[model samples]
Target: MSLNFKDGRSDLKRDSLMAEEQALPPSYSVQPPRQEAPEDLSARLARLDLRSSVKNGMNVSADQCTAHLKLLEAFNQLREDIGQIPGLFGIEDPIFENPETPDTHQHVQSPQALAKVRVAEKRWSVYVARAVARFEKWYSTCVPATMGGAPCNRLTGNQFCTVKGLDRVAYHGLPIKQLTLPDQLPPLDVLMVWHSYMLNPRCFFEDCFRYGKLDFFATALPWTAIDPYIDIVTFEFKPSVQAVENFETSTGLCWSNLNDGMEKTFSCPRCLSTISVPWTQGSLWTIANEMTPGNGFADGDFLAHCRVCDTKITHDYLRVLKFKADVQAFMSPSDTPLPGTLLNKDGQPGKLTVLGSPPESFFPNSLLNAGLSHRFLLLLDNPNVSMSDVRSIWEQGLTDKNLVHKAKGVRTRLLPKERLSIRRMMSRYWFNSSPFALDLAGAVIRQGSFVEKMHNIDWLHSPALKSTMERLVQKYQRFFTLMAENPGKVAVPTLDVDLAWHTHQLNPLEYYSYSDKMCYGKYIDHDDKIEETALSDAFTWTSKAYADKYGEPYSECTCWYCEAIRESHTSKLDRFFKPNKVQALEKLHGVEVPSDPLNSPHISAHNAVRDPESEAKQRVKAAELDKAYHKACAKAKKKGKPEPRRDDYFYYYAWGYPMYMPLYYPYGVPVVGGGGFYPADPCMVNTGAGSYGACAAGTCGGMAAAGGACGGGSGGCGGGCGGGGGCGGGGGCGGGGGGCGGGGGC
Candidate 1:
């Protein structure tokens, strides 16, 4: 019986069933029943309500419960449908997030991302538009009924509260009483629109003007930032005629007249014909021709034509006539009525009228000359020019011969001490006790040194010394006068005399310190011996001991002489020792002074008055020589030949001076030139032992000039005087009536 399980009966049943399924029609084989339409929503709801009832202290109904369940099921189905759509539900979906594939966690979009970003934008835009429209409508018309009846001003919260004269109440959590809106305020979404529109800077003023009076918010607007615009508009518009007239009337109080009945007279330079015209009836012209165009009352040249002769007259000449008229008006006011006045002091009728002339003419002259000093008046009038320039020009004018002679007369009449006292007073008062006075005092001190040594007199008390100082000052005054008179002349002799005077006063040893002197004096001849040991002993034993005992250094013994001396040292010592000074001094004094102490040629002082006449002759001769030399040089140049060498001999004799020495000298001599001391003469060569070589090349021009006399002739030997020879530098006789070979001791 078990063997029959694997039989044909099972196969036959399966085949029959398959044949039956295959033979049936597709629609008849598997058919779904049609679904009835859902019960009408209102009918269903009515039935649910009718079926619903409360029982057993519980208000429960099957129908109502069923309806609620159905509603919940429907809601769940709706949620499912929404979730099926892209970007609708779940953490995987997003509506506003970017659709682009993102790599970072923050920028990552949901897996169920949307393709339409503009759709979201459109939806938001629709919301904003609706909100704005609602807000605008409400703001335009809505006003709190509680406030006294008035039109809505469409103002901001704070402005609205202010206009209503009501205190604002708080809203939400923020205590914004100033901006607390009324209860009838629109929704926050709509209010946001109004806020944005009001706060926008571009539209703020425009909205204020359109919705409310701008005057109410004038204080709130930034007036300063817009003031330039306001000023532009104001200037562009013209004021009324009455306003202009009022302004003119108000400003006319200060006006005064210039022209009267008295006519101004003008004299033409060409015709020499005088013409009279009214002072104020002329036209002014600019000096630059291009400044004005066309011929009219305003167009003319600066020079005016004479009415009778038609001759051009300068404006300056016209101004002179105007000045005379003004003077006459001031003096005879009754006749002219002071140009502008209609009534005199006695209340009488006036002659003429002019505007803005009296103040312009009268004030300047009267105030400038109102008992003030010339310097003060100059400072007041010409503020641009400095006081020093004015003073210099003034002092130059004081060099007039008549003024100088008068000053000399006054000085010569006074006693020497009285003259000194006056000079000191003048130095202190007129010179303001300034550095200029100090320099003048220094010059006097240096000049006085010669007289002091000659007469063996104390500079402080000796009347002779004071007189000598006055004479030196007088010499400088004369020099200034000569310079002022003949400024264009070359080779001024007064300057040479000044240089000689300065040279005589110079002492080469004055600049060195005691230590330097002791070190360097070993190489030069000196009147006093200086030893290094002695200097060291003085510095160490005396200076330290004095400082330890007195608490201060001995300043006078070792310190610099004066500010002037220090300045001189810094300036360079060769300035005092120029060879020109040596030659000039020899010419003036008729004696030889050793230029270099190492070259101990017989040097002596002589008593000789400096002949100013001789110096003047020499200056004239030098100028002629210079002109002739330049003419010769120019002729040579024109002929395409080399320029001639300067005649050194002629220069020395004619200019009455020598050329500069070679800059280098002995160790003790200051190296004050461009490089160092240089011996100019071969005979004066430095021997290192402080001795100078003998003159193998004979005498220098300076020696010959010193020995020559004023008149051209040799002197005969008498009373220890040698025979005078011709001057060695090409012209003149020996100045001192002595020959080089004579026993009188050349």
Candidate 2:
């Protein structure tokens, strides 16, 4: 009844031979509407999966109840008018299921479900009142730089969002909304969405930073391992290098995972504590790769050579880095000055001059023989990041493989299956389609390479990439032709993104990892060999200190696997959990490392309360404490910020304070007030979340530049809420797959 794999081709067998057999449900008669509301778990599950049956909008799992709930919440928010306080907020009956009883569910369609949505304009007012209270209070102490409706400020705070008119047509034909968020979310949703997806200052602050509507930023696998070692550049790439993440499902941007130039978190293997930073793109630089401006490190070559380790970091291991900057501006440009605007191009804000002569193509022959995604795949696996071997493969594509045996593009590889795996990863890699990374996407994947078999990636960039890159030659003057460059000597530009390569030990796979090509069956092992999996748990955090420091500890963990285990347990089995206790995530993605919560001391907390109902919910929770810890720890290491509570659970309380943002809310008290917390620095405005609107004044997002002093300053006095039902559903608040991988099994 299903497809089968044969000779690497997807083939399916059909049992029915009739050419046109129209099928009809045996029970098509419309069942009378239930007179009463279904309150049991069985009823709830039947109602849920029936809705889940909708086609096309898949969330990679059948159990997307929370995502659905979040979506419904978003819909309720949207149905209400956020422009006025009276028109915000709403809610509906929570949907759930229990294995104890699997039958008798009420299958409610959208019309029925929408009808069930209860819009309490009063309820929304309560939420808005609370938000306004906090927001207005935040405005009293500092200023906000609002541009295009999104604003950032130490007082206004980092990543607080409001609708600037995504619905309103801009001069350009593009939509106003940038990241994945529910349609027409209320003011609070906007605030959380902005912080969760854009400005997460939690890494440095203790529990003072809050998460957003969506959880991707928290579990964005890449940052887990990468964030601990890098520092986000205050400035973007030189006017158009582009971002590394696509953030298509959500309108947001992510930092790069490449070792180009960011912070590096290297540690002394013996002491297992923080070590002196040897790399930085700005000012201080001790890293060998950083010292060598254009010549990036050879891919397959990195000697761990930590004075304590005194050896190679090994091919199986990678030292990753992460840079935390507010990249929301890069999603779509605002009404900022163009000459001054730097968040464009294919990659980041930096410019990549191919130096002398850009090769007409890096691997022409290999490219001709292989798929587009495989091109970047080859780059990830290559021992040397140079272009010589790649050029040789292009030349050999017309001849034989002997002369070009080096790790050329997929075209020249002996293990074509591995090539396919890399190709597949590239097709779905999160950062491929963001407008910022379009050119780099072109560089990574060839046109037509992902036809049908991939995530249906965009191919429109090829021609544009070629055209834009072509201008670099004329811009630099006399750089020969694309093919005339010296293949043996490649010139790499400095991006200050060098931290991308260092492993933070969080969810490494969440960001991206380079691995050798292999068959699907073997690829898993190869992934393990590269061990690019995210490292969570206190151990990894203790060394690099990531995710939610001092918030919640992974219950069990000797290695990073512990966090993954927790994520799995929380996702699908919350019902089975014992009340009021946490679960340990003792599983891991890689075999070599023992990153699991079972080995941790915190497991005792959850073990005393485990039950069948909560089995799955625990797994989805790993992203919380572990994920945030890595990002914050890495950021702290980069700036030499004092490291305090990288592992304390109490820290999560401060995230709601507005002091952290200066562009929009623009206010907060010193460390003593506002719940015993303060901003990282007064008006520190260049993080990716704080960048776009943090510097602009009288913009759609705010009325003043960050730190410039807002007129209605209300310094930390927030509104109160009268809880009740939310607005009707379908506001798009929860449709963005914003839920945690909160329902997985161990």
Candidate 3:
């Protein structure tokens, strides 16, 4: 039976217990493994309790299925590895259940069910750090400072590599051995960018078709497998010699020589003349380092004035111009097939298709939306580009009716919602691609920075780190639920939850499937650009809503107000604890006693044991207690008859007290100056207390249940009998009593 202490009541009943006992199985024989059962509809609906319509839009494939399974296997191995890390608390599957709640209530995940998610979140930082390092190494190795006779840098090189990797992932002409499988992933850098892009499945699908990377879109990256060979601590991995050689051959770039520097030479966007920029970390006024004005990539404000055309040139502007030309080709009506277009046997143009959907079906509508993005970028690049000019350029492109009319006639082939959704997603793709590419470049940079902060946190060594991570993961789930329930409303996450969310997104295929099911058929997008005031307001709303739903403070704080509240709650729970004589011994004995079962100020020993540092201290105290108890036991053994067996009532009444004391001693009562034992108070053996039954009127009939309540009691104290002066008597059968109001008894 599942126990829930949230409401301080048990689901147990005398009649139900008897019935269950009577219904026990006849033998201890093991049964055959059960077949996997389909998920209940009610459980799925409960998970999706969102504002929008629920739909299953996940595109599954053989590769994705294999990758998903492999990823799960890798995750299990990673979890076991993490568990073995020294100084971490051993894994204890804490049960969380409220059986009284309705079926529609969110079903709490079992520990095994939640294990993979936690592992993913735990290793999220490692993934980011490794991905960044991999990208850097590959960029330094294969891609140059310039590509395709155009100006390029790490930023541009990343974009080129992403497309190239997509090309490899989608290529069907390759031999079976050469195919990019779950085990054979693309270059780390390519995988990282591609992973983020896939977070928006709708956009990923259309973009894949746009570049003819249908295979790439269909096959999900085995994210857990990505870091299997890497060290979680250092977040490092060495590429195999064959893998390195493969990258060089595929890209036609040397892998050995490393080209280093920020200096970039590129053709000016307007002048069509070569311009060399000496990029530096400083801005205009910091010229002592020989830094050029308007050439500050590191400072995040790089722009150059073309002397020939007087056009303001930035890397963003250059990228926009290049992208415009690429998209414009889709509408050019050219006889030459585009990059992703399939060729016929005679080398003639075959129909452009993505997973069987004709590209012409939505080219006009999609391109028109792409124009919307292009216009936005053009205006953003240089305010001098008039809105009228952008509109005129866009209008001129639409003069061709062939692509538009053809798309209109293909209505039967495409659903209205599907076509509109594709167009909307393509528009979003354009919107994120320029200026910031928040979904692409921005995600990499932002998540990478956050991961650095996560690494600095001593996750493996710290005592509180495990619980801290658990809290963050819990909040992460709630944050997503909030977004799912609210739809378009803004919701801000605390830094901890943000880390968890970032890691969740890293496994794009799983995230996509999860969001599709949970968020009402809508992929909840993470908006990293909320205004300060708006973010603050959203956080407040989040905190209030979180408290209302979860019945706890949204975020923890060490501030005075929060501390005061914690203390208040702690004081109220103190009624459940037995009066600890360990505190009394601290005053009597000058030597320091270790913090443990009774000596520690916490109401429960479990709380003291939560921190590794605290638990280590508790161990020493426990050993000291053990030594003292055995010494007293040896002294008693000389008398024979085992000194009349110390009071069992002491164990019955003390809730959360350490029951496994040496020689059956209740508390860690210290030996004062190596004399007689400092006698503790008499045991209140009151019957009819809620938990396990206690002895009645000094009778020795009952025993306290391990990890169960001692229950509330009144004054029925009996004097101590032997050890010191008088040892308290054995316990009684305190049946059907008022249950422990606070902590569980010994």
Candidate 4:
């Protein structure tokens, strides 16, 4: 009974099925329904009135109320000032007073004005640092004790797990009852983190709405209570007694005492039984060690053992469960009944009532933050997909087509088109690459870490703080430019640049507008969960690109000795063999290197003191040099030649010997004589490494003019100019005397 396998009837049947599939509506065009996002609360924030929220049962003190108003005033002023900086927020097109014959260089302030701004900025940074320090302490220990069972609940779950959405209810998942704001303001430090978090308005709003944090979201920071200080070194931040009490009462733990021992306990995913594991303090072991397979909160292999379920809980298993849950929530039909907790407009327990659909009534967060979730759903459609397969999809890069091909149902047809259409509709959040949990966690950790790092290095308190900030601003501008140019590529920032970036994100409303207009027609979202290898690769690329575009080293040592060594072109070992050279280096720079120079402090320590007389002399000399530079550019422009390149008309810092080091360009980097995007001209490079007062070298005109005395040319170590000079790049150009100050022995 051999049947004819090549039957015409079979071919006809297959063709009919193919034709039917083709005739069906393109699934890509039919996007899943997503509710419109709520209007921005910029107006409400600008003219913030907390009377409504304050009436919600929390007792408010008269003193506290007064304090909050004052703090709010200061915060608003700071926002206004930060907003005016053109490139600080994002790339701003040159605004022209007159459309015809506009001055391309008009956007730039004079070098003197720029210097004043930088100085003011340095002062503001001190307070910012203090606020950040407090925030870190609060965030690390703010876990509530009612999370799981008694013993397991006292400690915070894995910081990484909480961040990655594994422990969904920790930070974002507080019970509905504890959602209201306390009348007293949180300590300044806690407020700082909150302030920065809110500045990322979209992220903050979505998080609150998703987690039923309506009351918290409506509350405002008590700006009036804050004491703004200029000096970071002496400024002491004291959270109000009421504020402290409120925090302690709510969390059932001491805010000051965060030590919970070496091991943290949590509940098993499968069983309700508590599981204990070794814990490290910082989130994801980022502060202690690199994330390897068996390190802190390792997302591979066994997480713990569950005795009740007789199940070995692995990271893979937890992720799978979470992913499945997330997918189900994301695919929920619009007609599904709203949760009773969410339906209560009054936000009172046991007072739920059925109401018509409203703007705030919908809970679409899973779909709103569905990038990874949607992608995972497609993979799960394949019945044959294994745990390894899921892990591979997330860990490795796969294109859209490849992802679609892996799915095994009618959903595959709908997803590709649906995702694309949905993305277009929700253009504002198109760049969000991870779950909301991961994004929130990353932003919190990075911002807190940066502020703390800045404070520890004494950058906020340094006498050379202005100069340091000036350089940071420039570097940050370049960093943002790189991000705008290269889409979908990770770019790691230096500590200085990262500080500036964080500051910009603090004002979320303005940031959104600026980013949308300037940065690729959408907001550029920050992601902290990028693989270490990818971050390294991005950093290496960033360094090279930055150097090429800006013609300066992207990374520089802030240590005095290193700067001295690099500037002088002498090795550290030179102190032993070429003792005279080392002595000259110290004398020329006016810094005393210690006997054991193994651990060096920041260069700012040596360069903090200001010499009024020396500063005046330098300013006078700088004025003369600045004129000469402009004259060179003007002469070139009139001759119909290219305006003198910014690289030309250098402000040379020369030692008594025949050494020359170009220190600054008073005018910003303009391509033509008066065109292009010009940044604020940096102040004259202060070459003195001691007291920030001594004249380290000669000026372009003469040694005496530079406030330095000419002497027998011997061992004058070079000091690289600070403003915009190519640090540690060009070779030294020597001129006349050894330097003004007499040589001191090393």
In order, what lDDT does every prediction score? 0.23, 0.20, 0.31, 0.31
The ten-residue window of minimal lDDT in model 2 covers 716-725
Return the lDDT, model 4, position 457.
46
lDDT of 4 by residue, 1-746 (tens): 11111211111222221121122111111323443864332222233232322111112222222233233333434423432444331212233233443222343323333222332232222223323434444443442223222212211111211222211121222222232233344553356557556533334433443433433433334333343321122344455567678766654434442222334455765466887654221111122212222322211223465677766654345445444554465345422211211111111111112222122212122232325446567776553444445434433322333443333212334332122122111211111112332222223322332232343344432333334444554455556555545433334565555544444444333333334333423333332222122222334445455544443434443222223223323344655765654453334233332211112221111101112335554465445445544654554367574432333222211110111123322111111101001110011112333212222111111111111112222111111000000111100111111222111100
lDDT for model 3, please.
0.31
> TM-scores for all candidates?
0.13, 0.18, 0.40, 0.37
Model 3 ranges off by over 4 Å: 1-206, 217-225, 252-293, 296-313, 319-323, 334-440, 464-474, 559-746
**Highest TM-score scorer:** 3
Which portions of model 4 show Cα errors greater than 4 Å? 1-237, 257-268, 271-302, 331-436, 439-457, 466-494, 529-746
**lDDT of model 2 at residue 292?**
15
Model 3, position 423, has a per-residue lDDT of 22
Tens digit of per-residue lDDT, candidate 2, span 1-746: 11111222222221211111233111111223454763343222222221212111111112222122222233233323332233222122223232122111322222212211212222222232233223222222211222223332221111112222111111111112322222222223323222221111111010111111112222222211212112121111111122222221123212211211222344543345554332211111122212111111121122344565443342122210000011122122331111111111000111223322111112222232234224433543443332223323323343445423432523444342222111111111111111111112111111111111111111111222222222221211111110011211111100000011111111212211101011111000000000001111212222211112211222212223333233323423333543222221111211222222211221111001111222343344344545644654454457575322322211101112111111110001111111001101111112122232121111111111111111111100000000000010000000000011000000
Measured with C-alpha atoms, the lDDT of residue 65 in candidate 4 is 27
